[model samples]
Target: MPEPYALLIEGGTIVDGSGERGFAAAVGVRDGRIELVYGPTDQIRAERRVDATERVVTPGFIDLHSHSGLMIFADPLHEPKVRQGVTTEVIGVDGLSYAPIPDPTDLEALAHINAGLDGRPDIAYDWSSVESYLDRLDGLRPSLNLAFMVGNSALRIGAMGWDEVVASADDLANMRAMLREAMEEGAIGVSSGLDYPPGAYASTEELAALTAEAARGGGFYHTHVRYDLGDRYLDPFREAIEIGRLGEGPAHITHFYHRQTFPDGPGPMLALVDDARADGQDVTFDTYPYEWASTRLLIMIPPWAQSGGPVQTKERLADAGVRDRIRREMAERGVLFAGRRAWDDVRIGAFTVPELIPWEGRTLGDVIADRGDDPVDVLCDLLLAEDLRVNQVTPGPWTETLRDFIRHPIGMIGTDSTFVGAKPSPRTYGSFPRVLGQFVREEALLSLEEAVRSMTSAPAARIGLDDRGLVRDGFVADLVVLDPERVRSNATYDEPRSYPDGIDRVVVGGTIVVEDGAHTGARPGRVLRRGG
Candidate 1:
């Protein structure tokens, strides 16, 4: 007879990740896929048997927006994500990534620029093309699957040097050609971070052209909408929708939410998305259920101050007149990037040097008060000393309005989790559990099945993963077992590193990676690509 099954997990209520009501079932796994999903396994034989009594079994979570592209190489076990049952994470987001550089030196420069956001761990920068980078990740035996996207910054730097300029006809053609090659090399789609250059330098027309190429390859446009354009409120998102229309492809808005600082209400923004979908545009969005956001400290500076490259940006920071000019500009603006609403609530973290280490987890306002220095001086001097690699946490999505998005028809989950600091956003550690514990269990905002679908199938469908995000007889064996009543996020704004309460067992490729909420030291994650 055939070999006994690799694993048999029995006695759990299966949610199935289909948005339907769950049923009690047993699951059988063989090789790396689900062999059978049915009732009792009393007649079955297996190498290992798991008593899943009193637990709820569902597909492992899929995170749409992740900043762990470089950090995963350092911490191959990837404790924070696997422990939370994230079996797959989409990276190369926010118009920042580490492949298709065409120049090793430029790759190093981009790494330094992103260190504050993506973390500069002690790993070798070995590859120069998309295929090589994917191959390396595949060989690394990472704890969770990584899906790569070709960022607009990497595309722009490859076609034209890192200069601020609207694309010419030839430049646009070159970028399109590069995108085609990247997609062929298994890239998912095009990603743009309008706040980060030289991708930020792209005009609406230029973005339309590149995304059109992606559309031809069965890809979509994932964007951090341009915040500096038009009214700086609804205008930025309007540009994103218009780009998708012009390019003729699906467009996904990432990290979407509502903040109190906006002059307009969340109603208009929600209606905008609804109207677009009703009018026959394939549109969706994702938001993390937390009140704090984290990212690189350099994003606070204006694009003009960051025009040419990292080297030029550093030189400008050293100039006394330049600092004074930026100070006046900040005064006129009266707020930091992304409409954070206030400066003092901005806490700086990820300081590497010993002197700056003491400043870690402290607010810039407190530092300015102690040093008797202007905000600009403290910012510029700190950046100069740190070599442009600092991270910060700022006030984010309002909880009152967040509830509205979480219940929207097209709303999904994307933690937008930054990985550089000891004080990363609590969502990094608690996103899935927070939704399960607070929104579903406590507040009854949405059903547990709906929340699981949002965390699993919704993102899988949006990002084009066919065999995952569901518990079926012939799907990949990425599953999680949890106590529904006890599941909750212990992570908070001040204490951001605590794991969730009730993740019992996590399986990746039919191997148990996490047992009893601890990593079992089995790394079976694959590097997910566009298609098989």
Candidate 2:
């Protein structure tokens, strides 16, 4: 035999990514898989050895909910994820994705809906269904394993072309047919952006039907609820639990905290999620360790005005009567001031327009304040000029609500930020590091081991990825080695593109991608499709 093939990771204190205690172990790799975990010995010959003398080795992290779908294919060298010890990422979040469109026009609309994913090179809008989209991912390796959730908005768009009107029987049937098609193509579940259209346009009954179908396929319903701030908070959560009960699918809430209504609060929010879990409808959630959340600026518009397509939305904004009505409703809603103030702390995280570059790091209120224009009008005109596809980042304070959620036994973490090369959001670069370095260490919120589990084992089990979470014999050798004391996120609000620190080495599928905290330019990552 030509020199027995093997590599050894010697003397590392392995955390195993299973919430178990760390212990000194030598993990051996053979045939590109974990071969054994035991005390070091002199018998076995090997090809390489990673001396992890003072490091903590755990399974590669899995991002449960990410908006980095297109970016992965756009830049396979995933600086945003792989550097954070993440070896897999779940995409097609917020009930919107760029796949499964039945026509070119619908594809264009989906692009506008998820403008945060704007940097992918121009590829033909050729895939006409969800299966085709998954197929597209298969052709592109990127740098990690990936799974997906079918976007409910895409389903609606496929059936009714973004109309706000209720679906007819035929329309509902078509939507169900597409949902079935996506599931058959190996989608893990369904997601809905209820706060954003055309998902918002769907009624309780419509959502129930779609989720019920997902349940039939053994999937869950992941949602950005219809409302998550102010007076609308608890009710929407209750509605989600109710939907889960009625549809027979588990419910996974996105982001998992309140921002607008109580930017400085989150206590009540934890109570609500706990209440749902206690009731036993299979409720779960994920969170990023940041005070701010990001989304499109389109949410500033009134619901009625948002009903029509983008051109109509622009026309309504220009009409004096419509403009006044939107302002009046915004004022009456109490959400406007709350939203605007929150937006004040927020910055333009990423956008395409050159004019908006000056406003990128500035607050929304400051943008209008400095310009001497009404905030409402400026908001409307900005959306119009940007063609309703501008991306924004809203930075708020992390309250006790988030802390409590992080402490929950079932709560996992997900950096909802997308990677846009140099324009990445702070969460993309700092989420896990901030949690380990700042939130857990400086704040003394969670023990380091507990925090690692939240990022590794917790998410792996949540998504049913069995082989990669723990460092054990028979497990995939996807791991991260770090110096607990030195690990920290360096990316900041004003400069969001910085890399983190303290990551000693990162291995994906037993191959080193990050060596001595620097990328080795290796592309060993794989696209992990369900049941494949």
Candidate 3:
């Protein structure tokens, strides 16, 4: 007689993550994959069973944007994401990753620059190659799967030093070779954050070259667009699509949102993608369903000010003349700059100093007022005082405009979750539930099946993962159980760390890692390499 199945889930409405309607079924799991989706009356026995009678069974969520490259090593349980039903996440986003930097000096400098966005974990900075970094995650027992991308910044720092210099032919060739090697070693694609140097220093031609290499390796280009380029509205997206066209590859825009500051409406912004897809360019986008956005405080400064890496950046922050120039340039360029309104609308956190604790969760405008100093002085002072490790939460999109992106056909979900400081973005804790509860259940923007499809199979297809994104037979068992009526996010802007409700259980690789909305300390997650 054959042995009993490893686990059996019974009496649940299976929402198969393929945008299919709900149906009553019994799921059988054996050897870490779904063995059968059987009828309710079928006789089955297993090592354990979950009575999901009143719950919805679906594929575990996949986050297309995550900043857990370092924090996951420090806290392998990864409660905030796993508790929200995220079983796999794409790291090395925004053109900022920790690996593929052969230079230790550059690695340490990058760490200082990214401390506010991704935390400064106490772990050793040992690995330099892409394969070694993924191996490091495997050794530490990551709580959820991570897919790595070759950040253009790492490539730039490797080819040329961490300066804002135009790439020569030799430099471009070196970068393409580096990107090719990274993809060969398991990197899924190349990513760029055009606002962040030295990757930001890379021009359209340079990115197109790297994208061509990635395309040869069956990869795409995932970018945080050059928001300051062209008109600062549609032009950024236009550049992304043009890169895809020039490189002859797929382009995926991350954190696609409509801000109140954009002069045009969301319609024009979305139309770029529609037109691109219409022309067979293979463009897609991901947006979190929140009105607020968060990132490092260093983002408020210009890229030229951040040139020459962290040491030079610190020197510039301390220079009086540089401060005046920054003020003037910020006024002149309007680089995510809104003057006093920007300062007033901004809330900051992630202070490690006792003296700065009072400023956490407070507006930058309020701090400037209290200190009776210019906003530039206050900004420079805070950055210098904290060693350039402050983060900001600011008003980004209006809720109505955000809903338009959510309902778009080419749009998927990427929480853009930043994990640092006392007040992280509520999207970190609430993105999936907010969509499931508020968007799908409350507002009827789309059905539950469509929402799950965006979070699961859509991202899986984008990532080229064939085995883990569905509930079909022979697929890996990464599943989520939810109470449809009770599922909602308890997290908000003022209270950001709260866990969600109605997520009953989560499974990763056929093992229950989250039960009753809490981490069960199971380390079943592995590094999911491309085509592995």
Candidate 4:
């Protein structure tokens, strides 16, 4: 019925993403699948063959938590991802996404909320429903495969207005309906941004109900938990545990970490995970390797103060009395910005505007000195101007903090970096390279085998990717080959958009998309769906 196809990736040492030691193997592909691997067969003879001697062949990297949502489609070349050997990215992260909006105003509000995925066109706004949004992805021939989580914020906007109060019975019903519809339309799961609006207004019961729907549809519940740094913030972790227990869906903790301010680091958090796992709840998580975290300037605003809508937030900034009150609350709570944290570790990352770009690689303290303004007022004004979509980075401890997660059985790696075409965070370009080069090859933090597994099979397994994240027969032919000794991420915070080095070749569905460290401009990737 269809034409026969074959290709051979010969002589590479395949890592296989199975946590097993690599061995020299020739992988064969046909009909967009691995026809044969590590065996002699007539199928190996093909019209195309790649000599990959001395190269590391592994399943293409999977980004478990990504913000590439619409950006990947907007810029199908998506060098920020492809150069890092990523073949599949799980987007719609941090409890924010573009689907299931209730109205045009709601959609506009969403676009303003996360400017990291900027330059999206209004014509791209044609899809209003979750199914239609996913279908839009189908028409775009992106460089990598994509999967999305139906955001908790999208559901809230569909159910209730962006108000600070609890939902009415009708509101709850409508929200649940949207969640159900999204899941049915092939969403892999539900992601909640507990720290952000609309979702911030949702109660634990609401979360439980939504997650239960995900479970019914055989999906996971991923969350950017409400808080991560202070005493009161630990309550959100507890809330997440409760959601896992109540929802009966696998709970995936997005951007898992612990602030240095805590006497205990990931120790207590890991213990909680153990306790939950022992109770038979499906609990897993992801973390980026860097010691710095990125988010909007609005994080300094007390959650209660931001409970009102953005209009009220802007008004509060204009009133001296209100501004002083907010400032006092931040001081009392030990909230810090621009590297002058009550705690010592916070740094600054890139900004939405070019003028702030000079501060991209510096500490928050340096940014404050450069601006010669109170960090508080600068932050407030930035939030107001950008509609709270400006980005900032906070410092973190790398050694133990990252090692603990990589060592954990259930933990995987994610960049947590938002994608905006070529104008992306360094993590988009450097995350996997840093893991392979700095962590595995240089510091010996992890064996090359372990590092590959964490980046590949572990995340693929977490998201239930079938016949993938492995170099086995009948599997998807998404693969990457690298010169192990030469691999490294060249993209630094100052030069955030640079591509990595030593990616020998990349194949998507058996088509060579990247050849010898350069993109081939191929569009062989697909829109992966749940249970498809």
Ranking by lDDT: 3, 1, 4, 2
TM-score of model number 4: 0.91
Tens digits of per-residue lDDT for model 2, 1-532: 4354367877778887767778877788876677655765456567888888887777788788787777666677887778877888888888787767778876766676456444344566677766777777767756667888888888888888766899988998998888887887788778888867777888777888888988887677888888843357577777777788888778888777655455335666667767767777688888877766667767667656866566666788788788888878777876656555654764654555787766655667787777787777887777777677656676543554567777677778878876543444688788888887887778888777787788887777666677778777888888888888888999887677888998888888888888898888888766565555
lDDT score for candidate 2 against the true structure: 0.75
Taken over the whole model, the C-alpha lDDT of each candidate is 0.88, 0.75, 0.90, 0.75
**Clashing residue pairs, candidate 1?**
none
lDDT of 1 by residue, 1-532 (tens): 7677899889988888989998888888987788655766787889999988999999999998999888988887988888888999999999897878899989998998888899988889999989999998999989889888889999999988788887889999999998999899889999999999889999999988988998898888999989878877788889889999999988889998888888888898988899899999998999999999888989888778888789999999999999888978877776652232355788898998898899898887777778887778888988889999999898889977999888886888888877777798898999988999889999999998999999899999988899999998889999999888998999998999999988899999789999988999998887888975
Better of 3 and 4 by lDDT: 3
| TM-score list, all predictions | 0.98, 0.92, 0.98, 0.91
Tally clashes: model 1: 0
For candidate 4, write residues 119-227 as lDDT tens digits.
3433557778878888888788888888888988888877776778888888877877888888788888899988777787778888888889888887889988877
> How many pairs of residues collide in model 3?
0
Candidate 1 minimal-lDDT segment of 10 residues: 334-343
| Model 4: ten consecutive residues of lowest lDDT | 337-346
Q: Which model, 3 or 4, shows the larger TM-score?
A: 3
lDDT of 3 by residue, 246-279 (tens): 9999999999999876887999989999999999
Provide backbone clash counts, one per model. Answer: 0, 2, 0, 3
